[model samples]
Target chain A: MSSDHSHLPSETELRAKALESLLVEKGLVKPEALDAIIETYQDKVGPRNGAHLVALAWTDAEFRQRLLADASAAAAEMGYFGRQGEHLKAVENTPEIHNLVVCTLCSCYPWTVLGLPPVWYKSAPYRSRAVSEPRSVLAEFGAELPEEVRIRVWDSTSEMRYLVVPMRPAGTEDWSVEQLQRLVTRNAMIGVEQALAPERLAP
Target chain B: MRGGHDLGGRQGFGPVNPEPESEEPIFHDEWERRVFALTMATGMLGQWNIDQSRHARERQHPVAYLEQSYYENWLAGTEKLLIETGLISEGELRSGAATEKCGKELRIPDAEAARKILTSGGPAAREIENPPRFAAGNEVIVKRRHTLRHTRAPDYAQGCRGLVREHHGAHIFPDANCDGEPVAHHLYSVEFPSRELWGGGAEPFDVLIDLWEPYLTLVDGNGE
Candidate 1:
């Protein structure tokens, strides 16, 4: 049917009408059923798993080596990688230069380790300027890059997802794995913020 | 029924929010709100507003609750509309669906699901099929293409001087002339002296833009 009619349906009206017709024909959508199914998988495979793997890597040098080299296999070994994990790649940030990621076109991310991408990552200002003026972009988030250090901007245009393995923060020298995991927020992995320190999180 | 990830800012067709800090308007149904949040978490902010008269027609027409399933169908339809509009492509739309499905399956909260879909695998992992025409360290020029459609390349960079820094692989080709094919193209890091992008005493070596291959051409020392 043509949408050229003078009177158009309100989104709410269309939704009500649409739902009314579909349910009449096919029955209830089992909305809660869908949610339960989603809950099972998330519990089974999600960011929490990715976080655990990151914690393991932080403690083990060998694990870190393998993680940076072949992230998918390494993550899979820990039971974190799955359907979307096949193309997962890990980028480690060092003191000299920092790596930041953006989809520019869309928010293509690695869900297993880093969790979900934020509103800003998929924003036009972030996408358009992040690659061109990364330093400035970082500055907006309060992340300043040294002039001497070249900023490497990764523009994710395909299925290849990225995670920023933030530098282990200073003064957290002896923090336990569980404690350290608290510092690894999703924003830190996006290069928008630095890894947290014990002092920063003190209540 | 717009593409989930097509935020209004990128399109440049709408005015900035009247109240930037206020919470955005939410859908009537909680599930609908969940879907909206999930879409935004991955940074797909586009939505379908009901055409005014149709909204009235629906109220007057009256329908069953079960037909609400059409809201989901409406979402699917909107995604197709975005693909045709060049706001996104089949690949992007498909991945968005995958994320939506995954979000539903995993029960991950909408914000969390959005983040997962945006940062995790989908188009982010797939390799750009075709390498860019240029290479890093090489001087290139951005091409000027004007249309009413949405594009990743900015207008300021058109016909401007830039140096290719690196080549990122191909993805969903946004150029409509190519007919919505997911062609391989390079994600070239093009350097634009701040002066070129924004006039006045800008930083010397500071340049910008990680442009796709289709946007560039070789610019020799004499300049193209």
Candidate 2:
């Protein structure tokens, strides 16, 4: 090990390294294995999967009905069942109502589809306020809902995960599933924001 | 115990500084990846179950639990579990050096196995012979519980009146599963109107929570 006396490894960094090395020496885990796990979450699983589901639903009314009726089976049909995704409930966004998802207890997200939750979704501000002052919180995300639109906040306190099937932007009816998927942002799925408008998507 | 991990309605936090989707990386730094991967790999050992893993993270002191960054908390819990389970010693965890050669009794998931297990991912819902006590549209009240231990029910949803939106079948009850045994119980998606939870003049909205059967009692009336 080379000397870096000028800046000792931070306690947090040191602790992480210590744990990894300890596991390896004990023959309990391989470093390569850890790398693989990280890679799986980093690239393999993410919002893209959820995007695919949303796009499919937009193009197919039957699939949309199935998604809202039984999100778990619908995801399974698309081969999207896994950790944090075993149980899923797709809440659709209509013109008259808005839906948002939050986990006040912890960041319990649909990993198989949405991948790992974003930093803000797991942060204290979003968690504490989402259930109470949701309009204010949504405003922060640039999602302003009218007073007439009812707000339904889903607080994930159990194994059940939620995905907001954001409304397809007005001009997206003729668009392809891939085109619609391009507008499905992670925030839209979490209910913090809505699906990107047609104009927002680069032409 | 009633730890600080529950952030339902307590106030005074600042802006939710969300990063731009294009700019935000999954793991902020190299160390985050290490901690995340370490937690996943160690968890696959099967020496501990998912509920126990959650309790480990939520069991931290209130101050530490609330203040620590997400990954920092994961490291704290991982360290605690390693020591408590006899997989890694306290001194060894601090020094990054192995002393006693334990953990032989544990199962190690290799790279391929790790991938498979995570993809297959453990599902908590288990089939139970007992029928669900409540059904959709049934009025129910969440009983207040002050147990100072691991609980899946949030403090905000407790002591409030709600209606059953859906029954999620039987799932492992966290309070009982803290010891790594699968105990399935009926879980329901209870929807509490904002007024019922926080009083009048509040945002006219509804909050839905997935609660186990034990935490709820059937309300005979339309609701007080």
Best by TM-score: 2
Rate residue A129 of model 1 by lDDT: 65
- Give the residue spans of candidate 1 off by over 4 A: A1-33, A36-57, A61-77, A80-89, A103-106, A120-160, B1-29, B32-133, B148-151, B154-180, B186-196, B199-211, B221-224
Q: Write candidate 2's Cα lDDT for A161-203 as tens digits.
A: 9999999888877899888899999999999899999889777
DockQ of candidate 2 (2 decimals): 0.54
Candidate 1 chain B has its poorest 10 consecutive residues by lDDT at B13-22
Candidate 1, residues A107-151, lDDT tens digits: the string is 556766654444345444565566455666666666666677655
lDDT of 1 at B131: 43
Number of the top-ranking candidate, with lDDT as the measure: 2
Q: What digit string (tens of lDDT, one per residue) describes model 1 on residues B69-124? A: 32343344444443444434465443332221211222223435443543343342
Best by DockQ: 2
The RMSD (Cα, Å) of candidate 2 is: 3.8
DockQ of each: 0.09, 0.54
